[model samples]
Target: MKGLTDRQQEILDLIKSNLENNGLPPTRADIARTLGFKSPNAAEQHLRAIEKKGFISILAGASRGIILNTEEALGIPVIGLVAAGGPILAQENIEKRIPQAHNILSNKIDYYLRVKGDSMVDVGIYENDLIGVNKKNPIKVGSIVIARIGEEVTVKTLESISSNQVVLKAENSEYSNIEINPEKDEIVFEGTCVGLLRDFS
Candidate 1:
């Protein structure tokens, strides 16, 4: 209801109509066809933008996880294991959209990275834990970051950064710190960790 564009309001109305008529939310394809979008991806883009504006919450990992006007829950995308050299946020890598309550973490999370190794266990991150990440946050030394080394992605603490070199530190004693020379290696910072979620069940 704030500053939604005409098209956005149209989509929102469509969602409401679908829920009222069919007792379920419309799929991305449904929105695409109704809105004359070329593809479902375009619909998804608009949905995410609306979610950022706090109109709805998108539950990742579900075909229909859109919740209307959720004030207590925020839908955060869940990322599974990334393929080598693939974009970190590629749609295929998203396992599901899960709802995280607003008071769970202070930072505004962009996504949740599913942990795969014990290298960060000393800091409490373990295998299968979903770590919330904020891609917009400024990174500094000691911040735990999601980093891409060549095609591989890993979560480690930012030990240090120099003009020519950068160091990534592992929390576990068994793993050695990763040292890279920026001039020779390709490294990209995806995001910094904000909080974590682990399913004990």
Candidate 2:
């Protein structure tokens, strides 16, 4: 916390909270959106400043690679597939609460969603992985998001948003991108993916 600017301290705290709760570090895009930094580059710059202050370590070529020097424990709810006509965070949908102490990063996580398919495997989100979700962050293009189309829910990257349609792309080539006309289709954004958790056990 020493030698870091106020914003840097805030980002560091977010990194700590994310690590404790989700067991993974937050991506630059996750930090940027949560703190309203306009772009992930701004978050990366702040992360560099925090790293210089000796609070966190940033690893290149990894999205959730920020490492904290200390440890803390916290629990976040893990949601399974959404139940019919129920809210995503409904008690019935919660599979379990996961607690972790690892080098995870991100902003405040609302819950961890248990992935059910291989559509996002190319981005490292595979079936049965638990992805951290933050409902408060602003959704943006290129951000991976948990979306609901009517009664079905899926995770995909937000490719583009136009005045007429929104495009969601799957990370795997086996799946086609989904395009929705806002005026004619019902699309609900549950939350944006901030981090991921995989259980080897």
Candidate 3:
């Protein structure tokens, strides 16, 4: 009750309800979806605000790991500015945490990616928007993804031409499709974009 608004209080109650009935805390996605938020990042940001007010604690990188009491699991790791040539879930890259994210996803989100460029604007994804990612999701023919090549992390639609030949297509015609040769290129599929967040303010 220190500094939480009514909405935050509702969120805290929601977590408690989910934990009590389902034996786990509500995830950022659950919170966002239930609260009618367009993005899970809204829930994440609210949780951060609540955490700052000393209502909860996050155990970064594991699921259902919010330290509400002594009956929680590990947590979800929220990464900061991704380095050019680094693994996506590297410990050093984590900036914060989400307690857990369940419900409605076979492959749960591994992290939240802040969109950096306009290569996918034709698809309605904008620069500075937050994109939710599931690193383990299998890529499809027209999947929008966040990937890493050398020191650059890019978001694009994935198209596999063969077992080892892949093309990264941008939504904008100004940018050409990037052809990948795994034998010659150090390429890593970071994750698929599952959600997006942006600040109107």
Candidate 4:
């Protein structure tokens, strides 16, 4: 909480707002573009200052990587399932965030959603699991992600079979693979699964 100036606070506000709106933190370039900085380095400097103050942490080697200390804020909406094939926030897409973890809920969570299927069981995510998703797109291969195929919201392991072909494969044999031809099917990635919350109690 030290080393941050008023200007840095403004930058933090802007960054927080952007995260709320997009479900992902902004990049150095994005910050620069938004604040009218001459270069991304300027934004980087401010971000470093913010990190030093314990307001955020920058994930090294990751693009647009920034995670706020959630304990400092509250009421981060938990985004549930996204309507596959449409905007992520569509009414049919979002669920509700029930307060569970004080450490997690205290921090600004953009949203929370529950896993409705077992397609990701191979990865240890199961049905009714609460997942924290950052609002963004273009997830990497092998990363567990949430995708929309049409009106249905599904949690699956994302695999890129080809440049234009994506395979949403299930972790269990009981389910089948969903092959998506970007040129044919309206497939869209809502975000990558960052963390999982299961209520064992």
TM-score to true structure, per model: 0.66, 0.62, 0.60, 0.55
- Model 4: residues >4 Å from true position, as ranges? 1-74, 80-86, 90-95, 98-109
- Best-matching candidate per lDDT: 1
Kindly list the per-residue Cα lDDT of model 4 for residues 5-104, writing each as its tens digit.
8889888888878877887789999989998998999999998888988988899999988887643343445556554456655556556435444455
Q: Quote the lDDT for 190 in model 1.
A: 94
Better of 1 and 4 by lDDT: 1
Ranking by TM-score: 1, 2, 3, 4
| Clashes per candidate (backbone, < 3 Å) | 6, 6, 7, 12
Model 2 CA lDDT for position 104: 71
Residues 12-67 of candidate 2: C-alpha lDDT, one tens digit per residue? 88987776678787888988988988889999888888877777777877878787
Candidates ranked, most accurate by lDDT first: 1, 2, 3, 4
Q: TM-score: which candidate is best?
A: 1
Model 3 lDDT per residue over 30-51, tens place: 9999999999999988888888
Which one wins by lDDT: 3 or 4?
A: 3
Residue 167: error of model 2 in Å? 0.5
Which residue window of length 10 is worst by lDDT in model 4? 100-109
Question: How accurate locally is residue 196 in candidate 4, as Cα lDDT from 0 to 100?
Answer: 74
